[model samples]
Target chain A: MTDRRTIYLDNSATTQVHPEVIDTIQPYLSEKYGNPSSIYHKGREAKEAVEDARKKVADLINAEPEEIIFTGSGTEGNNMALKGIAFANKNRGKHIITTKIEHKSILNSAGWLERNGFDVTYLNVDENGTIDIEQLKKEIRSDTILVSVMFANNEVGTIQPIEEIKDILKNKNIYLHTDAVQTAGKFDLDVKELGIDLLTLSGHKMHATKGIGALYIKKGTKIEPFLHGGGQERNLRSGTENVPEIVGMGKAAEIAKKDLEKNRIHLKKLEKKLKEDIFRKIPELILNGHPEKRLPGNLNISFKYIEGESVVLMLDEKDICVSTGSACTSNSLKPSYVLTAMKKDPVFMHGSIRFSIGAFNTEEDIDTITKTLPEIIKSLRAISPLYNKD
Target chain B: MYSKKVMDHFKNPRNTGEIEDADGIGEVGNPICGDIMKITIKVKDDRIEDIKFKTFGCAAAIATSSMITEIAKGKTLEEAKEISKKDVSCALDGLPPIKEHCSNLASEGLRKAIDDYLMKKKD
Candidate 1:
């Protein structure tokens, strides 16, 4: 195998587990492997660890420890937030409102609620992928029980106006849930300040292991149990705890909270340099998502007349990893709904690529990408039938 | 998820670019659908003397374009027209099921190029 260093720029998809997190989880997997449900010494140790993890995760988002409920994944958290709230408050209302640009988890959950006898309204987004507040105000009805919006988009990294949305739903008895899976570690999330009734966060997105996620539910929020069993997670989510991964996620959250500002500064610097270099070297490209109010590490751009999958493979050949929103990369053979909702041209949608930086990246990595990407784009455009320089 | 052969051809496409003074040219697919192939050929004694292609598509599209040119090079116009999508895909070891359409575009582009030449001669 070639010894070329692999440059991973797909942090938004999932980050590499941090060394500190791995170290923190090692003891739980071996020496302290005990069921949290047991009353024995090992069990108590495991239980204490789980509770400590909950506190760390809760602290990361400025939520109370009791408000944190660990789940299998961000998908599960989203499902629990949507379905739990919907079933419990069916008497209050059967209407739900969400955006068209939400992740599949949120969109699909809304769809499931729709099929199961609920009214749903999908709000449209502007060219920058920001939802309109006036439209939201018109859509919100007395019967509307919950309004779910992602804090930041997964593909485009557009930060939604959650505070304004919260203000609109204030004291209306309508619960607001924000899928903060992308924003959990990158941005400071104040659940009390934002007035978010429910929030979802994924562990793997913030350098923790997969198969672990957390949902923050404000106190006094009435929600039904998503899983019914041995009454784990305060009976809201019932399952034997995944001790190792939970501890890892907790440690990840601790590190994230401690280094949030530093990481954000590093990521913003890298993102700015990368964008500047790419825009300077390339022509006929359009940036996707909000120019200012976006995730620091996310850089989504569409190169005209070239397909994204081709560009991705070309980059991979050089040991650089990135993601694309092109239909060719997906099984559905349809381009990214996020970009489509933004009213991007279908042609440009086919050419969209997302580069998400992480803490592990350095200036050298950015330099390598800046040096290598242009050559790949040049070669691809040379053979592209649609690209005529004249 | 292309075969190694497909990746190889994509990395080093053969007979790329346009034949400025070609006898005929063929273009297939569209940007909306995300795959487009343009082929140009020079005919001599009813045989494809020189062939070139430029593609705007995924890995499968570029590989299939290169594979078709390699398969049809020096073949008579009649033989080149008979080349099927299967021939192009099989020459590249095989494409993914979704990408089989890319091979179809390559063969169709070749046939259209040949048809263009024949149509011009009849006039």
Candidate 2:
């Protein structure tokens, strides 16, 4: 399905790597192919490049460069942060707090922790997918060692109240970690100002190459090494440094930081226009997530009495890429757990479609979607026995 | 991932829409799983003279609906009753493993329609 006219709106899955990032990494892949650990001039060049990338990533999140540990991806970063802290502070406490709307990485890692003799409390989210601060506060206990929440949800694009959460944990002994994969590049995320103890960032979400991400470990936070090897990443994570990908991520981060305002505006404009047009065209269409505190580019909606998978396939035929709430990966035929957690009706959950707009999309792309989608929904609804096409 | 035949059937489905003046009707699957197929049939003596379908599902569900209707039309009720899920999938080249259940719905819907026809004939 390689259509030159394909409009990719699934940015939450991954982003198209920026040309500047590719340009920045070409030399590292070709000429500067030395290992960062080698004790020679070429190695020193590679080491300097890695450290420079570290600084750039740190700058993107407003963390000290020394506190950054490069990992394979956002999943690895989350694993390291949750398991690392859980292992290191096992003696202090074994209780961890998280929200129900976290990505699979956080939920799975928490599940592992729970299976391995640790206690975890999955805080319930409201209808908008935002966790209640009062519930989180009430859930904190003396043995609670860490609290991990996502900065913003990937599916519904609900921005959590991290700043308020920081205030709740300020006087406590617990460490706060956020899987900031979705919010890192799209928004102005300053870990320092947000009082985030640990932050996870994935390169692929920010127009950088995949397979390279960073974990922000605030100095003096108790954490054991999740990965053991040749004692790399300050003995936290050990692997041969991915020089080219690191350089790509660094350039991407620099560009993201510089273009933050412009990108935000562009995404917001597109999201607003698309939502407005779609709402005007389709009645009884339900919007998911927070109205104001959502990702700028996200527009999730449910077309009642129609299946989201059908809509996705129809849109795919039109060369417009989209995603449905139900994961088409496994044959289980289950709807989105995230939507279920928010207490959405089982029938409506199957109809939810997440249209995550990105920096690469144009107004023309939105126009194509807005023009074609209503007709598609109309046809599907006509065939639907539940829908009365009056 | 759907086969080319499946995509073709989905793109241009045969025997679409509802048979308003029908002899028998069958609806299978549910909206909860994001699939619901309603099959309507017109019977002449013991043979299916016409068949139409309306579906609310993904590509596979609609294609299977179309495929089953095409397989059943002009066939004796006894012969149409023999068309299994595997037969419908085979006719569409093959469906994805996950989507094989859609073909099951297709076969089930046809059988229900035939059963409805038999019940009506007795009435």
Candidate 3:
């Protein structure tokens, strides 16, 4: 505990809260604690803090402050976007379209709409986790009300063509929503330029506090509120605002905006080096997802004959935390559906590992992984029946 | 990491190819999720003469199936029927929580296929 020699590579899951963000919210947690809904000087201070955070969030996405609505988490934001947009646009269409590789948040949101009398079509992706724009165009019907695809896949890091989606939805009133949880802090994202009508952002994914997120709705977009109560967030979201987290999220957004290019370049360099080393050391490794249409901080590879879960446990013992597509859905029995949808062989699917990098990662960490992974993969593959026996 | 027995079975499994003209067989699991095994057994004179397998599965499934068929070879039908998933996994020196189900399904499939082979012999 005292040594502080830790390497955190699971940035997609979440990040350590920024010290500045913590400082910004400390006073609100202690003396300045007042409900933004209350009418007084202290409450007014809280209200101003909330509004300031709202403005920061909107600024990050290049949207107006009035368009931002604070929510509980990324999942809530996705739900409000999907369900809210679908319910409001039902007079226009009865079908909704999304991809197979969205986060559980968006996937489940689409599922909820399906059960409530709306027909939903889940678009398939190619081996690189890229959806066909033409196929999406063909699927979009007069009855199609919304097209919700994630900006970047959380598991595989495939960047969707949000601009192409925009082009497809140019004339239609169908809203285009994206769950940009993984891409938020890692990439330069502007909702306006991307033509995203509805976008979701999670706080913890970007070094802010957990249990806090926001959704961006275009000025004229009509979305029925999912959580209804007092007129907070323009009567769309109920309950008192978590002023401290909103402030922290705004600070996180500011930090993300300032550090985007530097982190992107650094992580890209590390990614290229790691891939080259992995190819040189373990040449049989196949990189999953799109080659260039992927996140700079994410590297997923499949060691031909070993098991991913075994590699995870071995690396965990060495204090190298990784996941075998270890999503909350089926972290136990199944490999990643994202990889599976990519049409990877079962042998490779069973052997894939996701090594995600973060802001704190260094060249030494990449070197550590490059050095340790090949040996571990070699040992595991040596014992694997697929390699040794067959 | 796994015990040497499990590792060996996984490393150099015996009788891994499929049986084209076998008396009985069973296939279990989906390839997209990893772990698919096709086990085939030949019954002769109330005793299993040959057992073979083909698996597009994880190490544990392939190892456990290879071990089960090894243990079942030349054994009586009733004895092979008594083979359990726990026995298969134990012989391979235990599996991770996730892959253990694959072994269980393999055992269940082996037992079912043998039972089907035996009941057919009665006709």
C-alpha lDDT values of all predictions: 0.92, 0.89, 0.81
Measured with C-alpha atoms, the lDDT of residue A251 in candidate 2 is 89
lDDT of 3 at A78: 90
DockQ of 3: 0.20
| DockQ rank order | 1, 2, 3
Q: Provide the lowest-lDDT 10-residue window in model 3 chain B.
A: B29-38
Residue pairs that clash (backbone atoms under 3 angstroms), model 1 = none
lDDT of 1 by residue, A178-198 (tens): 999989778999998999999
Error of 2 at A97 (Å): 1.4
Give the per-residue Cα lDDT of candidate 2 at A240. 86
Q: Give the winner by lDDT.
A: 1
Candidate 1 Cα deviation (angstroms), residue A240: 0.4
* Over 4 Å off, model 1: A1-4, A326-329
lDDT score, candidate 3, position A346: 77
TM-score of chain B of 3: 0.88
The sequence of per-residue lDDT tens digits that candidate 2 reaches over residues A1-390 is 223588998888888889889889999989999999999999999999999999999999889999999999999999999999999999999999998888888899999999999999999989998998999999999999999999988888999999999999998989999999888668888988999999999999999988999999999998999667998889898888889999889889999999999999999999999999999998877888888899889888988887787789889999898898523222447778788888888667778899988888889889999999998888778777667665
